[model samples]
Target: MSRELNNTLYQSKSEHNDQELAEHQETNKRLQRLGQEVLKLEAKAVNSLAERIGDNFSRACRHILSCTGRVIVTGMGKSGHIGSKIAATLASTGTPAFFVHPGEASHGDLGMITGADVVLALSNSGETHELNAILPRLRRLGVPLISLTGNPDSTLAREATVHIDIQVEKEACPLGLAPTSSTTASLAMGDALAIALLDARGFTAEDFARSHPGGRLGRRLLLHIEDVMQTGDKVPQVTPGTLLREALLEISHKGLGMTAVVDSTQQVLGIFTDGDLRRALDQGIDVHTTEIATVMTQAPQTAPPHLLAAEAAERMERHRINALLITAEDGRLIGALNMHDLLQAGVV
Candidate 1:
């Protein structure tokens, strides 16, 4: 092609690329601004709740605390989803609670509610037909009702034993048609109630662990060192007079990277680990000729079998060690564990 034609084509391509890049940058800026606006609005809605946590909030908490039965949460549509999460939080945080779909409540699920139970109802407009329909029955059953709604004048709020105003100036949705900020406000309010009740009941981490035994937190809090440590034949050990080469074999066979040097009575005299081996080798000592006691770490840190595995993990991290010897009150080596065991058990 001619030089003139080539120059024209390159200029056109360059202009097109520059235009596309500018448009892409503008689009990114618009998207980010929109996202930031939503966050600010939701944050404002949640913050507004701080002032509303007054007598009514306390009354609602008292009702739940006094109830003998579970807290029954009910709502419609998006409100229902938030209610389910609130119920779960309440249940996991020491309050017995469960969600009953408002729609289903009219269809025989209302039986789930009783005079001893407390009802927590959620609605942005406070006029959800399905949710409101169950309110009369809840009253007839003499159940205390705690309503969270954006409209204080609505029927549900007026009938509630304690009404928490979850009003938001506007929704996060640009169209102002969705349940954006309102749902967020409701969720924050629910979380506040759950945590307050948790504190009032003196709920602890151990209690939380009992409710969530299958989760990582439960494992860390509830698992004992005795549950994770290698016991009896699995524990690697050698006498204090054993050669370093033999101790190394025991470490290899047990796969814990260390072995306990114990007396005839199974009392731990010292521990010889891979780090000790490295130092002994640096001194040009023969593994076959050196006694394990000569190179072992004396008075190594030991954990009781009843210690929480999570505590053992923390101890190991603090001391920069990989293995631990489990000893009884009498200083007898009963078991052993390494960092890998903690990791496998999800205690780390």
Candidate 2:
């Protein structure tokens, strides 16, 4: 190509690249500002919803507490989705509750509701036909009814034993057609109700963990060092004078990649890990004749049996180490654990 033509092409490409970069930056800034505005609106809506809380909320809580059966949450459309989540949260937080789709309730699901149960219904307009249809049956069964709706005078709210208003001043949707602020308000109110009930019922972390046994919450709250740590003969241990070769045998036998070097009182003086072995080998140290204490790390990291396995994992991560010795209050080693153990126990 000619030099002049090549120079012109390069200039055009540079200008195009600059324009594209400018447009990208402007688009990102616009999106960020719009996101912030939406968050502010939602925050304001939640705050307004909180201000509207009154005696009706208290009455609803009392009714729920007094019920001898599960709290049946029923709703339609978007409200139904939110109601299901609320029911799940309530159930996990010590209040027994479950969602019953209002539409399904007419088709034999109504039998799921008993006289001892309390009904918590949701409808943004407070005039959902499906919900209103079941009101008569709920009333006939003598079940207490609590309604969450945007309209105070709607049929569902009027029929409710206690009505908690969830009206929002404006919808976050620019078109004002979609359920936005109203749904957010309802969800926040449901969370408030579930948490209040949880507090009233004295729901503890252990109770919460029991309901979430397969997740990180269960690991952090329910798993202790004693539950996952290697105890007794499984703990690789050697006295101060023990040769590094024998300690290596213990490490291999236990499959923990390390051995604890202890004194006469069984108090851990140092730890010799695979990493230390490599370093010693690099330094031309004789493993067969060397005493483990001579090459061991003094005052190694130790955790108590009562410590959470999650915390132990954190400790190992923070130190960039893979194993920890379980020690008593006076620093005597009682147990041991490794990264693999945490992984196997589902605590990592």
Candidate 3:
């Protein structure tokens, strides 16, 4: 929308004029119709997927599930890029797989293949030059083959042990030269394959986190405070009877902006933060002679050493605090972590 029209519609600060109101209503109607058209198209595409799940697709799944070695995916053009991502999804979801570009397979990359591996060939037309060149070698090696193509009777399909058809009547593109609907179909089919294997393997979040340790989901599900917390002598701790001034030295030395007041056995008694210092001065309490027991805040927020770093980060942010004392189940301070630790661990 143009800025002038947008401001007239939204920034008017009152109901629009009669003529402007009619124009706005007409524009909204037009946008609604466009949304309806897109929904209809997407519904047709998704339904095509459900309808295409037949015995052939089942057979292909069975073949892949029974395979002892990796699934070697290959394709030409748009199918190739989709094939690469599909292969990656399969690998991450517990199905061993990798994509080999058909063009590269003919240019000395064929050595990566073995007789034990299954070749998953993808092409809209089922006829690609580079793929044809490798078919002879694949046949010689006596490897099982799977074809994903629009044409069911092409040479590649004819030689395959299992053929999965991805036929579509038209391209989503207006020009018809660009691959759009066909690519969408191919990518959806790839997702179907990955999801099928993902369910079959009973893959859990932990399994996925093991594969993607750098991702946000991995950090949320796999990272624990014990893995990143400051433990032992580095944790700032002071006895409850310690003078307030002495606790300040511990906080400054530890640089966590807080000090834990504990008993002789190290069980938590209370905590004092930099904020507590400001309040003490306001109340005219002498830091030098006053015991931390008299001024320390009881029931300070603490986290278990086993809690996820992300969960701890959320708790701290919600409470508007920077640091948390990691305690054992018995309330003994085991470790400490602050906002900076989470940032360094890439879990923030």
Decoy 3 TM-score against native: 0.82
What would the C-alpha RMSD of candidate 2 be, to one decimal place? 4.5
Candidate 1 vs. true structure, TM-score: 0.97
Name the runs in model 1 displaced over 4 angstroms. none
Instruction: Evaluate residue 290 in candidate 2 and report its C-alpha lDDT on the 0 to 100 scale.
Output: 96
Give the per-residue lDDT digits (tens) of candidate 2, residues 1-348: 999999999999999999999999999999988788777877898999877788998999999988899999999999999999999999999999999999999999999999999999999999999999989899899999999999999999999999999988888877788888888888999999999999998899989998999988897889999999999999999998999889889999999999999889988899999999999999999989999889999988999999999999999999999999999999899999999999998886
Best by lDDT: 1
Tally clashes: model 2: 0
The whole-model lDDT of each prediction reads 0.95, 0.93, 0.88
Poorest stretch of ten by lDDT in candidate 3: 37-46
lDDT by residue (1-348, candidate 1, tens digit) is 999999999999999999999999999999999999999999999999999999999999999999999999999999999999999999999999999999989999998888899999999899999988887788799999999999999999999999999999999999999889999999999999999999999999999999999999999999999999999899999999999888988999999999998999989999988998899999999988989888999999999999999999999999999999999999999999999999999998
Instruction: Report the C-alpha displacement of residue 326, candidate 3, in angstroms.
Output: 2.0
How would the candidate models be sorted by TM-score, starting from the highest? 1, 3, 2
